[model samples]
Target: MLRLFSFGSGARLTMRTSEDAPLVICGHGMVAQRLIERLVALGHPFNGIVVFNAEPFSAYNRIQLSAVLANEIPEADLALKPQSWFARHKVSVFNHEPVTRIDTDRGTVTTAHGRVQAYSKLVLATGSRPSSLGISGEDLDGVLTFRTLADTRALINAASTHKRAVVIGGGFLGLEAAEGLRARGMAVTLLHRSDHLLNRQLDTTAGDMLKGLLAQRGLNILTGQSPAALLGKSRVAAVQLNDDTVMSTDLVVIATGITPNIDLARIAGLQCNKGICVDSRMRTSHPAVYALGECCQFGTHTFGLVEPGFQQAQVLAQHLCQTSEATEFSPGSIATRLKISGIPIFSCGRVQAGPATEDIQWQDRPEHRYGRLLVEQGQLVGAVLMGDTASGPWYADLIDSGRDISGYRDTIAFGQPYCEAAA
Candidate 1:
C-alpha cells in the first residue's frame, strides 16, 4: 500500500512498502523522469520505485522552458507526467524534499526533512545548476538565472515591469532567454565574451549569420564584451562592462553556463571530476549506485544535451532490469536544434575542420541558407545546416555510419537524394 503524508514545512511524503524491491532515485528532472519511464517499460515493478524531488512540482519538459517564457506554452503544458500518471504507475514521489545525504554503507538516503529511506539500488540524476558570473551586485533584485519553471515565472514577472534587459552569455540558453524576453516586449541586449555567438556550436560564419538573423528580430548583440559589475541601488538598473561602458537595463539574465550538481555525490565520497564519474554501464564507483544526466561524467564526456541523458537513461534502465541484451552505452552523434521559432539552425558532430579534414560548403545567399560538411579520410565527420535543414537527419546518418563518401564527393553537398542518385 502507498500512502501520502505531509511532512516538515509542506513537504509531501510518499510511503511505499517493498522491502525486497528497493530502488531509490535522487532528483526529479527530465533525466530522472526518463529513467523511471524506461525502468517501467523494462518491467520494473512500480512498488520498488521511490523518487526524491527537491522541487515542489513533478518533472517538466525543461526543453520547452523558452516556450513558456515566450508565452507560446503555459506552465501546465511543461509537465512530463501528470499526477494521475504517478498514481497509475504506483510510483512514490517525495515532493519539495531533497536527499541531503547518502549513507552508502547503510544503503540509505537522508532527506531534507530528516526522513531516511533505504534502498537496494541508488541512482543520482541531480542534473545541473546555472553557473554565476561571480560579479559584484549579482544578488540584486532583478538579477536572474533560468533553469526551472520557477525561474521562468520569476523572469516573466520581472519582464512584466522591466522595460530594458541585459542577458549575459550568447550560448543556447542565453539566446533563448534573449528571444523570449524580446517576445515579451522587453528591450534586450545580449552580451557575449566570445568573438562570435554560439562559439561552441557554430563556426564564425554561421554564428555571424545567426547574429544577423537575430539582429533582424530586434535583439541587440554585443560580442567580445562581458559585464564587470551590475549597478543599481537595490535592483539592477544597468550593467557596467569591462570597458567601462554602462548599459542601462531593468533586468539581468545570466545564462553563462551550468555546473553539474555533484555536491551530494562528492559528500557521499563518489568519484567525481567535473561531474560524477560513471562507466559505460552508468555504474558509479560504488557497486549499488549509478549516476546519469548532466551530473555524470562518462569517460572524457559530460553531456548537457537531452539526447545523451535520454540515452543514458535507456542504458541504465536496461542494466537495472537485468535485461538479457543489455549493452554498454555508446553515444550517438549528437545533433543540436534551436527551439526558437523561424530560426532553423542544425549542427551535428564536428562543426570545425581540422588540418586533415576537408570542408565542402554550399551557400545560397538569396535564400539565406548555408550548409557545410566536414569529410575526413573519405568519411563524413560533421555537418552544419542553417536556414534549410532538410538534410540534417541524412547527414547525421552518414556521420553515424562512417561510410566513405569520396565517390559521391562531387554531388554530396547537393544533399542525400543527389548523392544516392549519383551512387
Candidate 2:
C-alpha cells in the first residue's frame, strides 16, 4: 500500500510497502528523470520508485537555461515533467529535500529534514557543481555562477540594475552566459585563461574565428587572462587580472567549469576518483548502489554532455527493470553544438590531427564559413564546422562509421551531397 500526505510548499511525505524496499534515487535532475521515465516505460513496479530532489521544482531542461537568462523563456516553461506526472506514476518525490547521508550497511538514506528512507537499491545522480576561481571576494553579492534556475534568476535580477558584466571563462557555458547578458542589454566582457576560446573543443584557428564572430556580436573577448581577485566592498565592482589589470564591472559571472558532486559517495566509502567509479553497467563499488550522469565515471571518462548521460540512463534502466534485452553501455564519440548568438557551430571527435593524420580544409572567408576534416588511413577521424553547420550530421556519421572517404577526398570538404555527386 502507498500513502501520501502534504507537508508544506513543494514538500511531501509518503509511505511505501515495508515488505519490498523501494529504490531510492538522489538528485532529481534530467538524467535522474530520464531513468525514472525509462523504468516507467518498461512497466517496472511503481511502488519501488522514490526520488529526492534538492530543488524546489521538478526536473527541468538545464540546456535551455541560457534562454531563461535571456528572458526568452520563463523558468516555469523549462520543467521536464509536471507535478501531476509524479502522482500519475505513483513515484514518491520529496522536493527541496536532499539525501544528506547514505548508510550502505543499513540500506537507508537520511534526508536533510530528518526523514529516513530505506532502499533495496540506490542511484546517485547528484550531478556537478559550478567551479570557482578560489580568488578573494568571490563570495561577494555580485559574483555568481550559472548552474540552476535560481542562479539564472539571480543573474536576471542583477542585470536589471547592473550595466556592465564580466563573464569569466571562455568555454561554451561562459560564451552562453556572455551572450545572454548581452541579450539583456548589458555590456559584457568575457575573460578566458586559455590562449583561445573553447580550446578543448576547437583548434586555435577555429577558436580565433569564433572569437571574431562573437566580437562582431558585441561581446568583448579577452583571452590569456585570469582573475586574480574580485574587488568590491559588499558586492563586486571590478575584477583584478593576473597582470594586475583591473577592469570595472557591476556584476561578475563565473562559468569556469564544473566539479563532479562526490561528497556523499565519498562519505559512504564508495570508490571515487574524479567521480564515483562505476562499471559499464553503471554499478558502483557497492552492488546495491549504482550511479550515473555527471556524478559517475565509467572507465576513464566522465560525461558533461547530455547524450552520453541519457544513454547511460537507458542502460541502467534496462538493468534495473530486468529487461531481457539489456545491453552493455558503449561510449561513442561525443558531439558538441553551440547554441548562442545565432551562430551555427559543430565539433566532434579529434579536431586536431596527429602526425600521421591528413588534414582537409575548406574556407569561405567571404561568407565567414570554415570546415575541416581530420582523416587517418582513409577514415574520417574528426570534423569541425563553423558558420554553416548543415553538414555536421553527415560529418558525424562519417566519423562514427569510420567510413573510407579516399575516393571522395577531392570534394569531401564540400560535404556529403557533393561527395556523393562526385562519386
Candidate 3:
C-alpha cells in the first residue's frame, strides 16, 4: 500500500469512506475528458464514473480559449461536452470541489469539505498551471497568467478597463494573448527572451518572418528581451526590462510555460520525475491508479501538446477496459499548425537543419509565402511553412513516413502537388 497524504495542510487521515468504490478521476480538463469519452466508447467496466472538477465548468476546449479571448468565438462555444451528456452518461460530477487528499492504503480520496469517497480505480489528470518567472511584483493585482478559462475571463475583464498590455514570452500562448488583447483594442507589447519567435518550433528565418508579420499587424514585438521586474504599488502598472527600459502597461500576462500538477502523486508516494512516472499503458506505480495527460511523463519526454495526451488516453482506456485493441502509447511526430496574429504557419519534424541535412528553400516574397524542407539521408526530416499552409498535411505525412524525396528534390519545396505532377 502506498502512503497517505493531505495536500497543503500537513494533516493525517484515519477515517475510511463507506461509499462504494467506482472509477474516480481528479481534474476535468481536456485530457481527462478525452479519457472518459474513450472509456465510455470502449464500454467502461467500472460500476460508476465520478469526476472532480476544480473549475466551475466541466470539460471545454482550452485551446480555443485564445479565440474566446479575442472575441472570435463566444464564451459558450468553448464547451466540449454539454451538461446533459454527463447526466445521460450517469457520470457524477463535483464542480468547484477538488480532491485535497489521497489515502492510497484506503483507496479513497477526500475533498475540501472532508467528504471521503472510495474508488475502485483512480486516474490522475490533474493537468498543469502556468509557469512562473519568479520576477518581482508577480503578486500584483493586474499581473496574471494565461492558461485557464478563468485566466481568459480575467484578462478579458481587464481589457475592458485597461488601455495597454504587456505579454511576457513569445511562445504560442504569449502570442495568442497579445493578438487577443490587440483584437480587443488594447495596445500590446510582446516581449520574448529569445532572439526569435516560436524558437522551439520555427527556425530563425521563419521566426523572424513571423515577428515581422505580427509587427505589421500592430504587435509591438521585442525579441532578445526579458522583464527584470514588474513595478507597481498595488497593481501591476509597468514592466521594467533587463536593460532598465520601463514601459507603462495596464495589465501583465505571464505566458512563460506550464508546470505539471504532480504534487498529489508525489506526496502520495507515487514514483515521479518531471511528472507522475508512468508506463506505456499510462499506469502509475500503484496498480489501482493510473496517470495520463500533462500530469504524467513518458520516458524523458514531457508532453506539451494535446495530441500526445490523447494518445495516452486511448492507450489507458484500452488497458483499463481490458479491450482486445490493447496497445501501448507510441508517440510519433506531430506537426504544428497555428494562426498567429492572423498569419498561417506550420512546422513538423525538426525545425532546424543539422550539418548532415540539406535545405530546400522556396519563397514568394510578394505573396508572403515561404517553405523550407530539410532532407537528411534522402528523406524528408523537417519542414516549415508560412503564409500558405495548404500543403501542410502533405508535408507532415511525408516527414512522418520518412519518404525518400530525392526523386523530387527539385520540386519538393513546391509541395505535394508539384512532386505528384512531376511524377
Candidate 4:
C-alpha cells in the first residue's frame, strides 16, 4: 500500500497495487471494451491489466444476436473488435471467468475460479440480467429468454422444431421474440399484461392499432392477460392465462423486462437505489470505483437499451483517458425506436400531456400510419410514430432542443407536406 494525496477534501489515502499499478476493468460487455479503446487512444499503455470474469477472446457486438440466429450474418461478423485488436493493444482478457465478488476496502476482486486479484481502478459493466417471470415451470427445458448470444442459438434450435410458440410479454423484447419466432416459421402467439401492445411506448389507441395490424398478418395478439403458470412437466407445453385459459404452445419465450446486475455492487456496500447510483461522470459512491452500462443508475433513469449504454461507455472512456471535456451523457433527448421485421417505430420523450399540454396527431389506419406530437407551451415535448418514422430524427431534434412548433403545429400534423410548406 502506497500513500497517495488528492485535492478532494484535502485528504490523504493509501492505495494498493499488485507490484504493477494497472487500471482493472470488470466484464467484457459493450461499455468495457469502448473504455479500453479510449484509453489506448490516449497513449496510456496500461502497465498491469486485470480483466475479471470475461472471455479472453475480447468483446463482440451483441446487437447482431438475432441476425446471427436468423443466419443472416455469422458470429464473427458481429464482433465489435477482433481478438487481434486486444492482443495488439496488450489488454489481457479473462475469458469465460466472471468475478464473483469485490472487496473495495482491500481493493481486491475474487473471480469464480477462486483467483483473487487487486486493482487500482475498477470499472463495472456487468450489463443486465433477463427479467424472468417467477412462475412454475419457468425452469422448464423449452422455456427461453433472449438476452445473450447463447440464448439466441438455443432459441433458434428449439424454434426450428416447435410448431406453436407463445411469447410472454409484449414490450420491445417480447415483440422481437415474436418476430424472430415467426421468421423461423413457427406459429406465434404474444401474451401481454397490458391491454395493448407496446403500452409503455404507445398510447392505448396506438397500441391497439398496431395489435390489429399484427393480427392481420396472422400473428396472435393476446392483451390484458397475466400468465398464471407454465404447463409442462419438464418442458413448456402451454401458457395458462389469468382466466384459466390454457394457450397451448411448444415453446415459451419470456421477454418481460430486465433489471440491472448490481449484486456485486450491492455486496460491496456501495450506495445504490434502483441501480448502482452514479453521478453524471459514472462514478459510484466509492472514490476510485466507477460503474457504467446497464448496471448503473444516473439521473433517476436506468437505460435498458444499448444506445444509452454505449453513450455511457463513451463518457466514461473519455473521463478515464483524462481528456474528458463533458463528463455527462448528452443523449440528445432519450428516444425509443424499435426496428423489428423491417418495421420502424419511434417514440421519444413524453408522449402523454396533461391539461396544460397539447397533443396533435394524424391517423391513417388504412395505410397503417400513426403519428402524434405532444407540445407544451408551443414547444415539442415528445412524439410517437409508427410506419412513418422517417420524421423521427427531425422530431427527436426538436424535442432535444425544446424547439417551438406553435407556428407550424397544424402543418406538422399533416406530415412531410407540413415541412414542405414551412420550408
TM, every model:
0.94, 0.94, 0.93, 0.90
Model 4, span 302-393: residue lDDT tens: 87777887788778777766673747875567788886566678999886778997878888899878899888998988899998898887
Off by over 4 Å in 4: 1-20, 54-57, 330-332, 414-423
Cα deviation at 392, candidate 1, in Å, is 1.3
TM-score, cand. 4? 0.90
TM-score for predicted model 1 compared with the true structure: 0.94
lDDT of 1: 0.89
Q: Model 1 over residues 1-423: C-alpha lDDT tens digits? A: 554656467987675433453799999899999999988888884346889989998889999999999989888889888888877877888989999999897677889989977787899999999998998999999999999989999999988987999999999999999999999999999999999999888888888888888898899999999999999999888999999999998999999999999999999999999999999999999998999999999888888888889999999999989899887887778888764446788889998899999999888765768898999999999998888888898889889999878889878888888887877
Residue range 1-423, candidate 2, lDDT tens digits: 555645447677675534477888999999999999999999985356899989887889999999898878888889898889988988898989999999897677889987978787899999998987889999998999999989998999988988999999999999999999999999999999999989888888888988988898899999999999999999899999999999999999999999999999999999999999999899999999999999999889988878888999999999988899998887778888875577788899997889998999877865778888899999989988888888888888888889888898778888788887877
Q: What is the C-alpha lDDT of each candidate?
A: 0.89, 0.89, 0.88, 0.80
Flag clash pairs in model 3. none
Model 2 bad stretches (over 4 Å): 1-19
Steric clash pairs (candidate 2): none
Tens-digit per-residue lDDT, 291-379, candidate 3: 99998988887888888898899899999899987999866678888888677989899988888989888787667778898889989
- Residue 14, candidate 2: Cα error in Å is 12
Clashing pairs in 4: 53-97, 53-98, 54-94, 54-95, 55-95, 55-96, 56-95
Q: Judged by lDDT against the true structure, how good is candidate 3?
A: 0.88
| Ten-residue stretch with the least lDDT total in model 2 | 1-10
